[model samples]
Target: MTLAGCVSTPHPEKNTTAIPVAPEPEPVRPLMYAAMPDERFPIPAVKLDQLDRRFWRREVDYQTSERPGTLIVDTPAKYLYHVTPGGRAMRYGIGVGREGFAWSGRAIVAYKRQWPRWTPPDSMVARQPSLQPYSIANGGMDPGLRNPLGARALYIHEGGKDTLYRLHGTPEAFSIGKAVSSGCIRLINQDVIHLYENVRDGSPIVVVPDPSMSNIAVSSL
Candidate 1:
């Protein structure tokens, strides 16, 4: 199926199964004002200027490699590196998994969506029954402040099934360089927009086990 046509599909057999395929939610409109003509957020830009420049610098890098378009995320450094030819990579700052949310493995950008809808996993809903109302059947939440997925989402999958993990955008700019999400990695909205425009579906994504001691050296000025 074409990427654009990969929204939810009904499974008729789901009716008899214990795990009901929850009805797909309605489309959500972004809560933030639309991106302006210049692509800046409608809201005030986050005061990144006050934060440590080293942190921002750590987020991006370039590494030349034989694998062509492979991207790597060094969770310890809170950086995502997009590998380029000739031993260079473009790196971006990222927010990684919290203590219990950390995941390490190989995955692919199975699908991507612009302004994707937010759907809490069934496990989450079970823990917080109050969330049941917001389950996918209720058309999910209108893309707004309450939504956790932010403005863009790149769904990651392994072995041809959704890992339920994602590389998505976040309104909480302060979370960069910190571990404080369910499982997916988060990026600043502006940075995610930049990444979304550059990466394609099915791209190779390798989330390294840990960045602190990993010897994966990347080269770039």
Candidate 2:
């Protein structure tokens, strides 16, 4: 009967230290150079490792007096800018013409085409006889992944005369950052398609000259 009065001793309070939870990390978005299999010819994914990171498509702080929607090609810098509404630009790496082939001027995107024909000029054919098969007289090369013009072509013109130069895609993805022996201004196939979709038929374009070449600049636009 002497149960020790239920041992009236109270139990010790439990520890209640709060534990902190770590915040989740944000997802990393890979660049947009993934393969476009849905395309007519099914463009392959770009070999990003072979190209400089600067050549990748990106929006940059651009100081320009030109209106928005204008396209600016900086020859020496090897960059093309699609002037956005703000003082920014969607810059894309490009392959410029080598030596005497480099040109600078103001022009308009007179027209554009998807999977455009690759027609070598007679002079070009004369320089490279191998291209004779794709000459204008031969009705040009059929559009495809191998075509020099790649997936898209933005024809540039001034005063209604064709510059014969184009902002076009290229199969040679490695040629994006260097001056090439041919073509006016070349972009990656995916970048060119993006540019084509964003640009209008008559958007103004300015090619800033290399200091070693002409004195042209965006201010002249």
Candidate 3:
């Protein structure tokens, strides 16, 4: 009388049946280039449709041996990449210097400012006598929408010296993705504000050489 009472064999209907899963929702991309009325001088929205999509500020896959938080400015490509974790970067379109004026080398973000003053260097004032009023002695141009440094400016320094080169904003949005600045790297006002908020003092930045030039010297701002 072994197990005499009752015995029942149980079996799963089918082990191959898969449970239904909900699909993942698409990532939401914020409109980063929008207007900011809260700013001291209300910032207008960028004309995105007029600008090339490649030049837009966005995160991208960046292949580099450098550590995270490093900034690499690719002169020829007109791209400035702030390296983020996980082999990614926040890339922004930048305006480099024209023919005779260009800067390259590794430096640190010595300091940054919001709505920074624009002091035309003596060399620059010499070239454009009209800028004499904004010379360093005049306490530089007051921070405003019309200011050359735009909404933000990051001072670049190397070997414990101010390189006089800066990563700054420009009211001339069209200047982006072009080589027309005196020497400093320029970003659109909106983009500059975004970058200024992210980068910290002492962050490393490397402005690569422009291969088009015969001699890539680290020039002044």
Q: For candidate 2, what is the TM-score? A: 0.82
The top-ranked prediction according to TM-score is 3
Give the alpha carbon lDDT tens digit for every residue of 133-167 in model 1: 78978877766434677767899888888888899
lDDT of each: 0.69, 0.86, 0.86
Cand. 1 TM to true fold: 0.71
Instruction: Give the residue spans of candidate 1 off by over 4 A.
Output: 1-43, 49-51, 57-61, 64-66, 211-221
Error of 2 at 31 (Å): 4.7
> What residue runs in model 3 are displaced by over 4 Å at the alpha carbon?
1-30, 219-221
| TM-score of each model, in listed order | 0.71, 0.82, 0.83
Q: What is the lDDT of residue 125 in candidate 2?
A: 91
Please state every model's RMSD to the true fold in angstroms: 23.0, 13.9, 16.0
Tens-digit lDDT track of model 3 for 35-113: 7789998888776654567898999999898788888999999999999999899999999988777889888999999
